[model samples]
Target: MTLDDILNTHLGRRALLKSSLAGGGAALAGTLFGGWIPNVAWGADATAKYETPVVETASGKLRGVIQQGVHTFRGVPYGASTAGSNRFMAPRKPEPWTGVRDAFQNGPTAPQLGGPPNPLILGHRAPTFESEDCLVLNVFTPGVTGKRPVMLWLHGGGFAGGAGSAHSFDGNYLARSGDVVVVSVNHRLNVFGYLYLGGVGSEKYRDSGNAGMLDIVAALQWTHDNIARFGGDPSNVTVFGQSGGGAKVSTLLGMPSTKGLIHKAIIESGSALKGVSRENANKTAERLLAKLNLQANQVDELQKLPMEKLLAVIDNRGQGTAGGGPFVLAPVVDGHNLPRDPWDPTAPEISADVPVIIGSVNTEGTFFMPPDSPQFAPLYSLDEAGLKTQLTQRYGDQADKLIELYQKEAPGANPSKLFFMATAFPGDAIKQAERKFAQAKAPAYMYLFTWETPVEGGRRHSPHTIELPFVFDNPQEQPDEVGNGPDLQPLADRVSGVWTAFARTGSPNTSLTPKWPAYNTDQRATMIINDDWKVVNDPRHEVRLIIESVKGRAAS
Candidate 1:
């Protein structure tokens, strides 16, 4: 069926049980992060008023609208307010509102300080409404009878900054195109979401270092209870995200409470290498208390302080980089919410037996490197002497193998880009890393977004999040040739088509797209995405093994 054709069909929802989240470098010039929001102009006529009526969920009733071609229900709280006394504690269910709460405009997002104007990332710097009562979710469901498969999206901002409402992430297209219910959420960010509070001695604040993750699981509960009313099948849900969201997805895969809630997952551009250790988490929490000149016993006093005052102290804790910090967070592995070091354990922790799909972009590192940092240029320009020093510092004594392999690949190429390629991209590496360590034994599928965007003067390679628009078929703001002229529609049709197929049957397949294979230790295959997409085994060659040969000896 044509993309919109599927939506008009109003597919029936199969009743079931319950289930389940980066971009670019730039030219050496001006790149405003929020620049691309308006560029994606759509005929999103507000004239379409939705009368979806109030959904009476177990927690409360939510009033939503069916506007602009999709049924949009916004601002539905999944958890209770994370305010004063509840601050830094595992989120509690929100009190049921007396009447139907308005579910119209986007809800208040988690408060997070933003980065500078990053050109490659459009709409990132746009003003996001923040709040303490931000544990809300927005859903877009096409049909309304039984439960359709649901896809929950996690936003990426490195755990420090990112609004769930970024224009690029609007789920309308995915819902309408995939004929599946789509959910996007807002939760606590930065210190509010991830500060380690183990030493606080309060059972309420125990999960502080990983509250963001808890909030995600809580949202899933809301979906399990209410998605059927929106024509979504609660039993077949898939969780996925990019960057921070990808990392969050991986974390959930290793969690216990989150296990049965989701059936499938996809991780885009996320790595499982970095997370706080239990001992280190406690150490960090104690250090914060010490900074307050208070004993660990005085931790309760922090609960009494206003959130605003606490945020100021958190930001000034001498821990941010100059490239305009966003998520000052790192998830906690406190033997509870998370049972062990996600990647060190023997198998996937949370839903190891579930199906999995994960991968990343080709030139993914181009996005994470700072605009004016020492690692700026690349491996190509540095002198032989300088290269040796950097290799030793980053790879330690194994610097020789690292330098030899990398030099053979690029010879005199940009080392910065090469390093990111070998060490970072193929996002599957980190996914596999987590998989290898997890006792979770689910089947896994993978892919790499190899399409290069049409934007000129920008980095030609597929940096980070460029795959988003194509994946969801987000329309281009200005008129060009495709949707509004500037869209990657043909590619979107193929990508989003495959994604919806997966939502429907846990396998992405269609006559128009290539037949994808499930990821396994044997073939170790992946779908190479582009206009001429193809599924290939042994993608990226020995780069995977070459990098793995130098594991733990990398860098922070």
Candidate 2:
């Protein structure tokens, strides 16, 4: 109950003095609480009768700040400044500005590591200033024209820490509750965005192991060339995120310069089935040039050494090991920039005409457990012989048939809530949305969220970023990870109306939830949400066949 007491109990006090007056007034009070103009009252000369708002773009003119009616624009700059020799190369663009620039603030935050002490794993509240000339972005719009429909977002910290100016990703409540145009970005992370250094020296550092996914493909080519002067709809954008920005929308649906620059995508709780295999990204770039002893023709003196000695050799080489070991930073299939393994073996016929949604969160390992472990506060008083001695010491000999199929799918559940709902299943984001609903030609939804944050006493279940302030309708910006509830504004108006009706129309059919369907491979339909939204089908189905028989015994 603190984050300024749930932002002064739901943004009051003249919307916190119009969000401490500036930086686009806290992104226009995080987009006027989404249900448009809920009670627009600002006085004390409403910051001397506001009026800022500029626009333009093909790399110039910005200004921004409208407010109640929504407009925003913080930090802007679509690329350039990955800092000195453009760090690990490949983002470029930006350099065009001339007048009207003052985009109000925010810009600077890709040099991470000021996060994760489990404030619900990365959705942490404070700390937003960092740098390395962080590529910048942030918009929020509701006007500049009428084309509309364009979301973008991406934040999550997995590619190595977040920042699309995270105040819980304030895109002013999904740009005035889906009038659309949101934006967000801030690129490059860990060792300046996945350092690979192909063959060490200079082939102009090839694609330096995907420079932070080509700085989200140069901010989707600057939202396909300046999102229609902020009114949006650069061919109906819609790339969403949650968890490492849903693994950067599953690596931009296997990027080929993101075919037609994204039509739609969602991905929450980060699915990312694979990447980082140019032989473990060139043996983690020759173990970061033998820990910066530097050779292979001194790889341009390893880009002139600083960035805190390449983040102290990626924090003493620990970024590599999720069981395959030795490849540090992420994103790198690199056969000409991520040539394979997006949804793994399929789903990338150049984003088979786009449309996707993916999901997760139902005790996502209680926001990645270990909050000062000693079996983390005795896993909420585990018994039944400490849940059969921690499920026969982690399922050896298939621990009594996986604790009798999760005690018949959660009965009196507790071996730390059946080990955080058997490691929060959405088995690799539903096997990458069941290989894009069995080879897409567009259309692949699926969801699970299952709300459970009654805050601490409920032990933050339904964790891993409890559906980002109910999908940015801003559940009062992390009321200490979503609490002060009036049952979370009708589940943040049915999860921001099924993500702005799947970004205008790729299909998330709103009117509060039901007929979702689409994810096929027979009845695997899903949707679940919570506070009563339905559409189930294979909801649990024996924990998806025991997580596909424990990943076929860990891929044999």
Candidate 3:
């Protein structure tokens, strides 16, 4: 079979199978255990699909399902669904159920346009699931016991098109060896999640603009209140995510509401400093309601509208931020949900009490926008000269200086890699974000993933989310899961061990490796993960200083 067939083999097993609703019993084919070899053709073989597997939770006894080896739960509402009646409203508690709730399948995903399309996997049908009742969360736990550290994961689809059960977040190995609990959550997104109806005199949606964010907070509450049953700790939780998830974590750092909910954070190639403000959020909401010819009080009409029409309107101008791009749906500074731009508020200082692990890949902007994209007109015009001009406009005369810096170290870096780094690393208030927490005395640790894969042309050198498989210990590149071998397995074991150690004790001390120190503003040390690892001071120190000192003076 070809790559599609091979991938589909996993798609069917991982999603369709393990996600079967007979309480979600058929979904787990092999995605959970596939992390071992990273790239392994562990084809889906239909085995037993349990209607429900009992789990002892803090709230009492609970029964879930076992899909393949990975235990799965579906449609477990973290917050009340924001459907017809509750459209654009502050998240309310999901009703507790007495009878066993069928969790064989996942709940609906919030409506959105396809983000950074994964044609290889998500080629099924672009926009399918859409609804207001989308505030659901899923949990994947292994047999490991005794209050494991929980990894509360949020998906990345630009705050728009993604669900908690996407293929990439299989939690089997993470739960098994790391002895951690992994949860992927679903919340209101896009128009339904971000609509600012609070000023529209609508009682129902009085606190809307940041409803989606509130949904996330609600999920964390659920974890705190309920996660002890599946042999996981409610207190020792690490909130982590990629892209949009990273941005959310950043925003949460500044939200007084998020205090005491989580103890640690890990941001992978995403930051919210480049997100929405209250003014812009309200403006966007007004425009959306104008299209519907309804006011916030007309919540019923808005909720009743089909999800397709709703999303088409929300995405009218396309999904991304103007300075950014489409794959970043964000929270508005609603005062309640988000008080200010996370970077401007110095969340690092606000969350100084919480340990943090934040990083960006060498080339983080690649996967979201293809190198061959034509939409980047005016700048990346067909002509090379125009592209250079566009580059200069964005980076100023410093464009060449920036390129020189990247070229010096990343000599073999491809055009795509160059573009990605210049835009992301030290980009979008990241340098400032680091500075904020560094000044706050937060025990922050930093890193840069520099491994260029042998597959995918190696040009994407740890592009955007490449560190995921390494973090998860799953390499998805090789044909049919034929992999980079079990040699790297130790790395996963080691890193995850460090992570757990930190969660349990607040420091990543590993007897197997050298002592990982907490971050200090003076040294700014960072851990570098490659085939082999090293602890190094900032990799982009020179570039960071240059950008900081010459920022306003640089080109356009």
Candidate 4:
């Protein structure tokens, strides 16, 4: 059969057959055609249409498509299937193959609860398929010259939902604009990833609690060993992620195994100071076992049970509720695999040599706050008396002082604006960055996404995850989140340029924005990202102190 005929058959069968079976069929067909189905046989006109760029990986060869001068590879397996016995275990390297494999479509997303339809949070297009064997990654590169920097992306679903194939994360723009290689990964999540079966089951399940994180490490190892073939410099890899992905970056920093694997790190919005404590992890394990009605010795039954049963328990466990008591499906502080808290009492020493960039949005809480909240009703039209009442009720004894301080700091600010400002201080990112700045030999940079959106009548005001499209240089994918104003493209260019620059060098400085200085305890220099980017030293210092003081009192 001709190459077009074979591809047509493949596409039709792909919908009817399992992914593994489809891959196997393609490999068999390629072998029958002498390792490659030549596009030249179809004539000059057909050659251009059928031609695919092939790159050899450590495991096998892959065929990718070229579009607009960039070669794109999708659904490339970095690890073996995480189904059956492999479930809840560390990722294993995929079996090597001999024939060319087609990587034309995205792999299945990790099995997860359906997320909100809000495009601002979940992206414009959601994954069409999800399965247990979802350990795949995508790549975008200029060419296979092995000279470009590799920027690895980790998606943000808070360790539960999301995939690397989200339309908003498409690497075409970043790869072409920066002349760099871009990669995105998908791995185990939620119960399949972080279920603590260490003490409850066989020694094989010892690392179950951290299996999801290990999947990422395995993917990095693959990149280190194979990224060069895709025109990427494995030695110059920079790992960047938003929200849960940011937490993953933070967690990787503490891992000794990650030393020398990543040269730089960027944590956007998700600032996790610590993982689940061992005690809490054990409690969650106990709860899971009780829910399953399985004895300690019968933990193997977990592997035998259908994925639906486990997922049902996860749903009942309330994994992502706002007031959820404690996160059930999260990485645990296992002394062996995950030695200690990533940045609880202090920053990790393993990543002290790795330069870092950390920051958050201006109005993070707006994303989480319900529109129907009664407390926020006065924000639409608040007189001085109403402002005082709301501030007093929320801030208690410090209300009068905070109001005065905020009025002096932001003249002509309304009650709603002050509410958002107070709630969106990015305390977590700042606190973690402070910890790293105090001890790291390498320099650290900080930024605040201050560009508010006109979406939802301006309530978005730079909420969580708003900077992603800009950072990826794909602002058009999120017009609602970025607004229809003419200023977006320029801002996106500035943001993506700085991010790619950071990957190339340790610093994020570029010609577009002002000189961004490394964050230090004394100055606390921060870059405010907007249409007009500016550097502010210790911005809103008093407000931060007040927030910290309140947290201290609550903890005490």
lDDT of 3 by residue, 1-556 (tens): 3222433555553444333522233233212222221223335433233434565443334455564455666557776656666777778887565644445455666666664554223411222444566777778776424677888887776666676666556565566667677888878777777776666645556567777778888888888887776667887888888777787777777777777888888777776674476667666666666777877666567768876788776564543465133222357776656666767635544576777777777756545544345753222222435435545777676767777787787787544456666666545535644665556666677777776554434433455666666565444432212136655567666666666666667676778566566666667777777666778776677777767656646534
Report the lDDT of model 4 for residue 355: 89
Q: Give the better candidate number (3 or 4) by TM-score.
A: 4
lDDT of each: 0.67, 0.75, 0.62, 0.80
Compare the candidates by lDDT and give the number of the best one.
4
Candidate 1 displacement at residue 164 in angstroms: 1.7
- lDDT comparing candidate 2 with the true structure: 0.75
Question: What would the TM-scores of all predictions be?
Answer: 0.81, 0.33, 0.81, 0.89
Q: What does candidate 1's lDDT look like per residue over 351-417, in tens digits?
A: 6666767788877766655434566655435565666677677556666666677668667555554
Cand. 1 TM to true fold: 0.81
Residue 479 lDDT (model 3): 21
On the 0 to 100 scale, the lDDT of residue 521 in model 2 is 71
Stretches of candidate 1 off by over 4 Å are 1-49, 125-127, 316-328, 370-420, 423-441, 475-487, 552-556
Deviation (Å) of 483 in candidate 4: 2.7
- Sorted on lDDT, best first, the list reads 4, 2, 1, 3
Model 3: number of backbone collisions: 29
Best by TM-score: 4
